[model samples]
Target: DSNFLFLFCYSTYSNKVFSVTFLSLAVAVIIPLFGAIILLKCPIDPQPISFKEPPVLTGPLEPNFKLRQAERLFENQLVGPESIANIGDVLFTGTADGKILKIENGEIHTLARLGHGPCTGREDEPTCGRPLGIRVGPKNTLFVADAYYGIFEINPVSGEVIPLVSSKTPIEGKNLSFINDLTLTRDGRKIYFTDSSSKWHRKDYSLLIMEASDDGRLFEYDRVTKEVKVLMGGLRFANGVQLSPSEDFVLVAETTMARIRRYYVSGLMKGGEDMFVENMPGFPDNIRLSSSGGYWVAMSAIRANPGFSMMDFLSEKPWIKRIIFKLLSQETVIKFVPKYSLLVELSDTGSYRRSFHDPNGMVASYISEAHEHNGHLYLGSFRSPFICRLNLKDV
Candidate 1:
């Protein structure tokens, strides 16, 4: 009887064990298969990006606290002063709400409007206009690059905004998705600008950078001919555009690529392109010419080591990138904002001149532009509600 009972119990337990084992195996296989299917269905198409390793960020600015102690001029009054232009004692900057604000003696006034409607947030950018670049052209005419409205020429005195080019307008059969930073030639015969991304709008900048999109481009618009030409294509989040002091070359910032490229506009190398500076520590935004004979580049956010490094590694894996991008929210994609701020100076030949850093962002962060005027450096930001001013002597 004892042998029979033991045999019966073993039979019942083995049957249950087989069922459990089978279920566990099925789940183990099906879970991964399901995930694979979902990933395959993901729409976040990404491409590979390869470049030389970045240089060491070390410099004389190891502990420089310049930006942290800088002065804030228009605190909490404006939103996203993306670029700066100075005429005499007056400062002009573009805002997120499609308005160009003029600053004089610390007072702020609206200079022009790019759109007809009020933009309360990013969703209304198309309707309300978001000006990303501003420059003072010939005869004090303000050139603005609105993300949604395309290129514009604003009369600083009359507050009149004229659309020089619409975003819907196509160049070389390609329409601009985001018209970004702009610069005008000395003789005012031409204007150069960047289209940050051909696949995403200004509000989706996080996605654009994360995806490492190569749809960004550099363009030139001839004022006399009213013709637009694509000077460079297949760029990675192309941003700020500036011409060489001698007007022989144009520099375009490829933000996600962490580099600047020079397109020869004149001289023997005319129509050729080359790297100006490579392997930057952060995403390059607007670059401006300094009164001291070099250029100042605003490093929007310093690349966060470990985290950003991992992302860059994953950028090469298309399948992994698609899944991660599909699951990540826009805020989470851009949540890696570094607390540090930076402004790097380079010679006209693209050699390093100097660098300034704010390790804690006590004074400013996400600075998009740096302009030198009257011995003072006025800084703009993509998100800061104020423009910061710093003394060149102190720096």
Candidate 2:
């Protein structure tokens, strides 16, 4: 009886081990098979992106918690104030809900509605009209670059909206797909803007960055002549547009490449292009002229960090990006990116002056632009619901 009991216990143990091994083997085989099938069915055609070595976070590029001191303005009252423009104390910004709003004395008022009906969320962005770059144009007017509907000239007082450039307007034999940021000349006659992508709309911007296609174009528009001309082409996710104080050369932020490019508009190198700043510590968004005749570049994503940067790692690996897109949705893929807020100041010659950081993104993340006015910096974001104001004297 003793021998029989011991044998029975051994038999039971052997069966349990066998069952566990079988389940492990099955999972090992099934997971790769499912992944292979998903990779094969991926729709994205990724292009190889050559990214420079990330800059070292030393000297002026060192990380800090300065941005944590930023104060929120009109918190939860609006959403996605992506760009900010102002005349004296009155501030103007475009919100995610397709409205151009005016803020004065802590009051928010609608100046103009670009799209009809109620905008429920981001999915309605294409139809609701996502306004990106806003600049104070000639005669106290506002020039807005709407990602879906093209550019418009809006009267700040009466809220009159006039279409300056249509999305259907073709330049260089191609229709504009993603009209992003714009900068006007001193007289606001000639407008320079960036078309972010030829294949993706504003809503699918994440896909454009993952695909890393060089289909972006920079354009020059003459308000008087109604003529639009392509200034530079084949840019990778071209974003912000800013002209130098002298208006000799214009700078465009190539977001995916983590660099700023200089295109000569009225210099000895007219019609030529060169690198303004390369291998930034993060992806640059909108660049505005600083109070000291420099440039304030807003970084949407920090590349150099202790944590993983999925976008930075995928920059050189197109096959990996294809697999990621196949297995994960756009929203899921974006979740892999770490959060951080950063802003860099560049000299007139593109030298790094200094940088501000919210390394943990406690106060703000995905800072889009920094506009300096009256000893303060008004910050904008594409993801944050409210704007931030940082006192320059304190920081």
On lDDT, the leading prediction is 2
* lDDT agreement with native, every candidate: 0.84, 0.89
TM-score of each: 0.89, 0.92
Model 1 lDDT per residue over 356-377, tens place: 8887577878789998889888
Clashing pairs in 1: none
With candidate 2 superimposed using the best TM-score fit, by how many Å does residue 106's alpha carbon deviate from the native? 1.2
Candidate 2 contains a number of clashing pairs equal to: 0
Alpha-carbon runs more than 4 Å astray in model 1: 1-43, 60-63, 304-310
Q: What is the lDDT of residue 114 in candidate 2?
A: 78
